[model samples]
Target: MKNLGKKIIIIFSLLATAIYANVVAKVYPKNVVSGEVATYTLTITGGEVNKPVISTICGSNVLGTSSQTSIQMINNDYKKSYVLSYQFMPQKNCVIAPVNVEVDGRMEQSNSVKVTVKPAVQDKNADFVVNLIPSKTKLFVGEPFNLQLVLKQKKDAEAVDSKFIAPDFKGFWVKGESQATRTEEGDFIITKAMYRLAPQREGNLTIQPAQLKIATRISSRDVWGGFMPQVKWKSYFSNEGHIKAKPLPNNAKIVGNFTISATADKLEINPNEAVNVTVKVVGDGNLEDIKSFKPYIPDVNVFDEKINIKGNTLTQKLAFVSDKDFTIPPFSLAFYNLKTKRVEKISTQPIHIKVNGAVKKTELKIQRDDSIKTSEKSLHVTQKREVLSKVWIVAAFVAGLLIGILIMLFVKPVKFLKKEKALNLNDEKLLLIKLLPYKDKDEEVKKIVDVLEANLYASKKEKIDKKILKEILKKYDIS
Candidate 1:
């Protein structure tokens, strides 16, 4: 009887828990300003001891309402209310934005919301920020680079009316920047364009200060980082950003540094026998236009060299094609150093080249006399058979006939052709008949006719002529 009473109490507890879980969680925002701070409150009667993690629903165009941890709600069991403060900065003009609410591990349904941002005024101008995109501490002449600017924003602040103004770049051309875009948290982004900077004179060039103005609906946010209490009420705020640029620190040329150096495989070369010499200029500078390569020595022709340029380095390969001894000339290059504020020079060592002309010209030739000797070894190669051309076949037939006549006049041929014996005719006719199929009676008859006609016309080996001609003429009833 006591156990039965305990079972009844357990049943009652489960039923009460189910009833408590049915009260759905609800959170609603209190007066939300466009691009300004707002507050939301969550309520659940007889709620669970664990607070439900809340998040914005997906596919919402508004910024503050969409990101995780955007809204923070403090539990208030005493007042039966939990409140979360948020800042809304909508990028698009949404008369009805999709604002999502999440609870119970699943994102709840979204709420249709109207959004508006207060227009910025002159008195509510924001501050300036300067950021050097593609920021490099060094540069060289004839180099291309990119620079960008952005209007930065503080936490809980919106970047509305803002623009970047480029500074004066003396002796350097200013390429334009791309159009601005607002980040998800409402920051204006400005991208600088690309440019080719050619420094006519080498030196350090300082870029001037760049400025920007950002217009906002209210006064500026605190510059220093700290918590801005949610209870603090302000009707207006301002936001702005600016920029300034500085030159490279060291005495670096626009492209880099310029210097020339040369080297030879050997000082002596036999004429017609080639020797290789390589000249390279290493430094940060334009190597594309350094065309002429007259190795500062005697008998060096610019035409004998092939020049190649990669980045700031110039390179060349010289083929001493001449048959005379010569000396390379000394070379010096000039470049600018930013730290020194003066021009720097680099020198190259002198070189001597000897071309021996007394050597055999055939061996000295570029075609290589060794190749001719290799071809001589291949001249005796024999083929299994030579396929005769039409001209050769015709010539052979004519020659054979002439030789046959010569044999008839000067040698013995009385047993054959025009002097045939009965045995010879029989043999010729039998051999000709054997060429056709034995099973075909018609073909056998045709062969017999062909044999008789062949004897009346010419030798057995030759085709049947006048006798066949007569038979064909008779079939056609021709004269």
Candidate 2:
């Protein structure tokens, strides 16, 4: 009976222990270096437990959180344990305050842990270092350049399992190439990457440091003449750099090395016909800056299609229409060339076209003359026949006049004159009125007219650009 009672008491004690929860706190790496990560774990055992909530820890920044659970059968009783971990980055040498947590509706506290943050460890015997190199440090806004991320290592070291972390390019546009090239020198091995970067903002810009995580193998000879090797992993960082981007003058937008050229499918065509014009730009810089290649020509219909970019080439296609022969003015683009260090201008050649008038009807005139002769001969016929012939001739004359009026309205007779009467355009205002197209109020036309008037009437005669007069005539649908 005594043994039976003792066994019952022990079983009850075990049950009571299992029914309650046990909690404790643990800190890893009591000593740490500044800027290093430290781990803190909260352990819970026995009965079921909710997740532990962590309190803020001083002198450290919480980086992340994680949790784990496990179950075991001990002495015919089920036991469970849970671990909640928090990762923190220590800023300096200081005492970490006690962390408070709640588990299973009970508040639990962890003991304070002291951390000795020492200076960062450096190895001067390192075999290699990573570098971020740029093609140029100074640039104008909207200018583009190349950047290289390189890992240069000594010949004695072998690099393996290399990983890279790129910097945050906040104010720049970056085009990155994925493949990394490996090259070997006489005493070094290099891994490199190429990238194209364009500054999106003006003023001072900084590129953050790049990181490289790599493992290297070193071989040594043992005392017994046998080779012993060891593999170690280390992280390397590249220096942070700055780029000075200057603002453009007069709000100039384009910057690069480029050439502009234009071509037309048909230079000459009838009125209301459309001609296809294609403009091409070939260069090594930002081709996307040329978003449009549309030129506004007076009295001509212009329709611009989408801009196409393939490789280093940019092409824009447009359709043009006019009612008379016209010369499309030369198109010019002004840009700063980084290589030449000067503002250069490129322009397309002027395009000229001829428009032919509608064909005239000579047969109608011949018919009218024959009808007049027949009427004159009718005088010798009988009186009844003469009367009928006279009526028919009058009717033909009226019909011909009506047809001529309709032709005049369709052909716009004023524009068909071979030469202008000087008396009709004695006033400069009259000349401008005749030259201005109803649909065009272009400033270029007005400026040309002013120059023409000054050259023809000013005290000092200046040579006027004859091309301007020719353009004005075509714009108004005049011959």
Candidate 3:
């Protein structure tokens, strides 16, 4: 009977201990970037009908609590849960502080949480990635603008909604939103927000709450803690906020239009010669529209050459021509000049060219006196040829007289003397004939025979050169 009473007492003590452990409120997930909404969860167990109240106060320059949310509930106990989300847009960087989440605003039985609002980490492939197209980091007022939201999900992640709460535009509005596209990289990206600014005001603004909800993966493994391991939930907050666009200034500065100017090394030129006209484009705005100055030039035929472009400076050579007097007119300069507060129109001075005559017309014609002198010189050659013909006739007369003297001396009264001369010649010939019959070939007889043959009978018409005579004599066996 005493053992049964002891067992009853042991069971009562164990039941009473489990009765007191009730509602617990905790704030977790410590790291967060500015403008990211974070969730704080409340778990209650072993409690009666006790109402719970949650409130928050945002830190100055750290977080603004004025815009934070609040909620109260009356039915609790038996493992009930509650969730609240808030954000901190830190004005400055590196201010690590704690946020106050008051549960019933009392410390005795109430709970409080301390968290750090830090910067966000860059996530390369996020579920809902906000893309600033053309990513024009630098913008002007009333500029055509657009933004793209890229959503990537694994097969198990939940569907996303673009109706998520977003920032407020104080001085701007969206111009258009492009059709969404699902790229092969497994992403659904829809271009949104073609924005432009209103006429004037200028200041930096923020897109308050850019929110996105995505499914979180759950795993099963029992652990001992206040964490409630198996409990599953989905939804979220994103660090990528919206449009911090500033309006262009009301009194913006205006830049001047490009101007073209002409310069020459010198103004004078010879006829049929060339002069170079150089045009320099100086100043700002679009320098591409300036045409070649050659076409606009008059009297001068401009030559085109390869243009030299260096940064904003443009230069090229222009060559011109004319036989008579001509001028290169000054070009007009029109630009939105910042000085003098108006568009200025200016003209350059006209350039003058003097071309001297090359050859006089009188000098171009042939003279009659010179033509006659040259023609007479040509006739003089015929006159000389006529005189040469008369000389040849006199030479023939002299040759006939020489032949007549020879014939007269031998044929008439000179016959007796011819017979006597022949006898003398026969006697000399006898010497050669006697030597030929003997074939002795003595050096003295060889010399005498060579002289006789050269004078009397070798058939070649050219002068009997001594070399051929000597060789013929040697071949006749006469040394």
Candidate 4:
């Protein structure tokens, strides 16, 4: 009877605990700015609890999570609780839906929570500020422009470490340019980073705020009774930037001011030899917008090499091989010129090539020996002549074999016998052609090609060190 009573008491206690078990959800700092992290915590009490499965919090996946377990005894009754905390960064206002958690083998749902996220506000009076400045707010599609991220910090606020994060350029082709430049102003220091942006589509595109995280050095006492350096990090955000891109007229794909020029290594080549031509385009706009040039000629095999672009210049290498004379037909490129504010076309003149020593086909005719008759004496003379001809043929074959053996024994093999002409390393066009084959294979070779093209086509020529070029060629065993 006493055992039964104790079992009943234990059952009652379990029932009471199950009835009192509950889960609650809470979020601190219900309001926050975009790009700021928010914390959500779930508390479970009075029963065995399992880890909750939270897909997302405040419309963003949890960045990290942590849990805490606590136990207490009050008035001879034991109490236990579990708390799960999740961290997430919210980009906009959102509502966190209810999450289900298992407690004592039964599911329990927590109440929903709402968070208000506001756009980042720039504070001018703060110790540090970030600003995203665009060169132009309005431009045509495919037009190239500059975007600068400027950071200003007061002289008094010394940062021990700093990092900058750029926003996703959704509708633009972005290229990072030169390194950031630092300058000092009155009572503040300024740093600027430049990026080249070209719109991919026509629309009103929004660039999210850029973030700058900085850490300041501080002194803290360690357990060893010595002061240690500690850092406190803070993030500053730049304002959002908007760009209005308009469509180009006449379905033009390029927007820039450019000039096209072509040059060939030779206007005349031997039969089966290649005539190398380089077509270059140079100006101050989006050079990458230019497409590869395909020149068509009848009965000629044309090979287009990879296009090389450097700064405002673009170069394309081509080789034409044929046994007959052919003409490279003129081609044109149309682009919306920003300087002219109108559509303009640039074209290349037709190039004619002549092939030397081309083989020609000829018909051969044979006369029958039966058309003539000869006496016995004449026939005997003809037989003697045939025997002599056979002996001479055999003698010539043996002599030729002996000569070939003598030559092979004495002569050393010459590598690149066909390329006997010394390459002109000073000539940008020739150097570019030589280095192009190795461009994709080696990074240093690509840089050389870019420098060569820039020197050849860009308005501001890049200096080429012939010694350096020779060293690279020697590394590749290229003469």
Candidate 5:
């Protein structure tokens, strides 16, 4: 009888525990390739609980987490449940460690999960193959190289949908990429994409594999005894690539063959007028690494424009405004010449400008006429001098009034004019034009201008926040 009583008590305790709470862990898509994202969910039911603090999952970093809660009326009792999900990218196959969740002031353990992370698969018998090939794997920093992605497919196999995911290209600057081109090679059709890469840092870097997802169309019989179209999707991955970037010589900012030249619109200008000079650098290497040329001259107001890069050429416009003659010093660019296998320097000729209406200091001399001894003669001379002074003063006043009137009528205040020409934030191209002048002066402006320019000119497009743009315009009083 005592044994029966103990059994009854044990059953009641188990039922109470079941009514309190339960925790379970689950992983979706049990098998995945390395570098693929997988979802791990921890479900807690029948009680209140705190968020689970999971440091890692499947020996990989957790990218992010989210939670969802729900309430259900089961058997006339309110039952609450919580589901917490974690997103992680697994690099290898590993077992997920069990996590403990605190529920109603008590800790409940969850079951472990096993995940299979296999290396990227490339089907040998597939209809298509992709490859990532580099022009040269070994190079110096700032040296540009070509990386090409090529895909070859059988002409008979037609895909209904296709997407190509390029490598991340970490630690390297993507100078540019060419549009994909298709050509027929014997029995196969070939598609190729070329990218220009410049290493930003010296090290051994790995370029992750690129992926191509394709969907092929197939026919299936429907219930109506008619053929229906079906789609089957498959993914193909390219082989990984490695790059060994060696360090450049100390203080070597560029690597390639380049030439520097300067030209001025006019050698002579009036006082306060600007001398517009263009400094251009033409090269076959990493032209994007070239910095803007800022010529330093005392008493000269130098306004350096943003650097403009077009293919192998870089151009920077500079305005030097001064009341006196000043020399636009020669600009020099130093680069490691790949052909010569040595550091080389190129410089522009110094340009000397002449100010046509510059003011010059001259000594004035005063002489008294010793021959004028008579008082009447002296008085007449003094009256004549006074009359001349009055005439000069009147003439000066008249000229000043005319100039002020002309300025008021023709030239408006810069700030007021800019406000009047306030830009529509929605018009990115116009905003880009307005922001270009300020890019060299402000870092924030430069960043925004870069994004806008990329959206308009480059193949890749980036999102622009109107609120942020408006704030920047307001901050700079650019309207």
Candidate 6:
């Protein structure tokens, strides 16, 4: 009977332990800013537990999870527990969904938790501030200006590491300096960055805010084994602004203060030789807007080249060729000067060139005797006249007629007529067919066609540079 009582007592002890098993969940902070991480914890008591499986939480993402199990004897009583921790990033404010878990052999769920996320805000207690500044708030299209970003911090704040986010410059072309400078202003430390911006179009444009994330060490103290330093993190944002870009005047290709000058590589050259003419434009504005340049000189052929830019300077090279004396008419460029607040034209002086005449071909001749004296029939003995036979005469006439007919059909008459017509074609007519896809908007092409037409109909024949024309056609992708 006593043994049966001991068995009942053991069964009651097992039941009591099972009744005490339970699971609980907890979340820290309950509020955070976007991009900051939050944490969640799950604790299970009195039994073995499996890893918690969290359902999709609204407005937040789960980054990772970790777990630990432990047993201890406290006050002469045995105790066991299982714990799980989760880290997450919140996108916005929302209620976190209930988390699920399995403890021993039974399923359990935790109560839903609410989390709040706020937009980025300036910290009044922060040790630093960021400012974004522009040289000008209004500009003309194709005009250039400066943009600067400055970071100001307390002199005692040590910035161990930092991250910077620059604004997106839409509808504008931007170039940044390679180096940044840091300076001290009284009790503040300042770091500055600079960029050059050129407006690409005319309209209202917005410059987004710039952000800076900085990590700094504030203090240090001696610990158990070593000195421990305290670290703090802070983020700063700069104010955003708008810029207005106005359009340039019609036919005005440049917008800034600039000077233009041109020169020829040779003032005297052979008719078939070529000369390189270079035009340089130095300025503080956008040079890409000026696509091409043309000299308004007739008779001289001009082939333009791609523009080369070096810093604030733009250079264009042209190859000129001609068969007779000609002048490179004054070249002109129109631009709007912001300082003068008016449209101004810059021009280069006329260039006079002397082209040597075409070389004459000299024919080579071979000397030989035209007549030969024949022996007079062995010194006048029966000199029989070399009389042609009737059959021979007929054969000779037929051969001569066949040769004449063949020459008319293949050598002289038929092909010569077509060649004469081709030679009569004027320069403009030839270019029309050769330059199949002529761009009418291109000033250089239009000027070339005008000069060709003038030379064709004018009373005095104007020199034509066939070599330069061919080069121009080839440069424009013509066969």
In order, the Cα lDDT scores of the candidates are 0.48, 0.73, 0.49, 0.82, 0.85, 0.73
Q: Give a tens-digit lDDT track for model 4, residues 1-479.
A: 99999999999997776556477788866887677667899888755888877767765899989887877665798778888889888878878888888888988887788989877888877899989899999998888889988999899988889887787789887744769899999999999988888888899999888887788888987534589988766678988889999999878788888889999999998988999889998876666667789777778899998888877788999999999788998768888887777889889999988889866533332233332334556888999999999999999999999999888777865642456877777777777877899899988788888887777778557777778788888988886
Candidate 3 deviant stretches above 4 angstroms: 1-23, 32-49, 55-108, 152-163, 167-200, 203-210, 216-479
The list of candidate 4 runs beyond 4 A from truth reads: 1-21, 46-48, 53-55, 73-78, 158-162, 201-204, 214-234, 246-253, 263-277, 303-308, 317-323, 340-343, 354-479
lDDT of 6 by residue, 148-176 (tens): 88888888867889888777787787743
Tens digit of per-residue lDDT, candidate 3, span 1-479? 99999999998886664344233334444554555545444443322233433343334332322221223343562343333333333322333233233334432242455556664443546555543333443444433344444444444445533345443445544434455556444345443543322212235544343445443445564222233333233333434433443432333322244566788766666786776778777654323334565655554577878776554566777777776667877766554454444556655567777667743345433687788888999899889999999999999999999999988877777655554332123343454564464335556556666666655566423333456445544555433
Residue 90 lDDT, candidate 3, scale 0-100: 32
Q: Per-candidate TM vs. native?
A: 0.27, 0.49, 0.31, 0.59, 0.55, 0.48
How would you encode candidate 2's per-residue C-alpha lDDT over 300-403 as one tens digit per residue? 78999999877668898998888777787787778888777778889999998666672333698889999988987785566778789999999999999999
Residue-pair clashes per candidate, as listed?
36, 0, 2, 0, 0, 0
A best-first ranking of the candidates according to their lDDT comes to 5, 4, 6, 2, 3, 1
- The model with the greatest lDDT is 5
Candidate 6: list runs displaced more than 4 Å.
1-125, 175-179, 216-234, 249-253, 270-274, 294-305, 321-329, 352-479
lDDT of 2: 0.73
The digit string of per-residue lDDT tens for model 5 on 415-441 reads: 446646557787888888889988899
Query: Candidate 2: how many backbone clashes?
Result: 0
> Of the pair 3 and 6, which is ahead by lDDT?
6
Q: lDDT of candidate 3 vs native? A: 0.49
Q: Could you tell me the TM-score of candidate 1? A: 0.27
Off by over 4 Å in 2: 1-42, 52-67, 70-79, 85-102, 105-128, 153-162, 175-179, 186-188, 214-235, 249-251, 264-276, 286-288, 298-311, 319-329, 351-479
* lDDT for position 248 in model 5: 85
Q: Is candidate 2 or candidate 4 better by TM-score?
A: 4
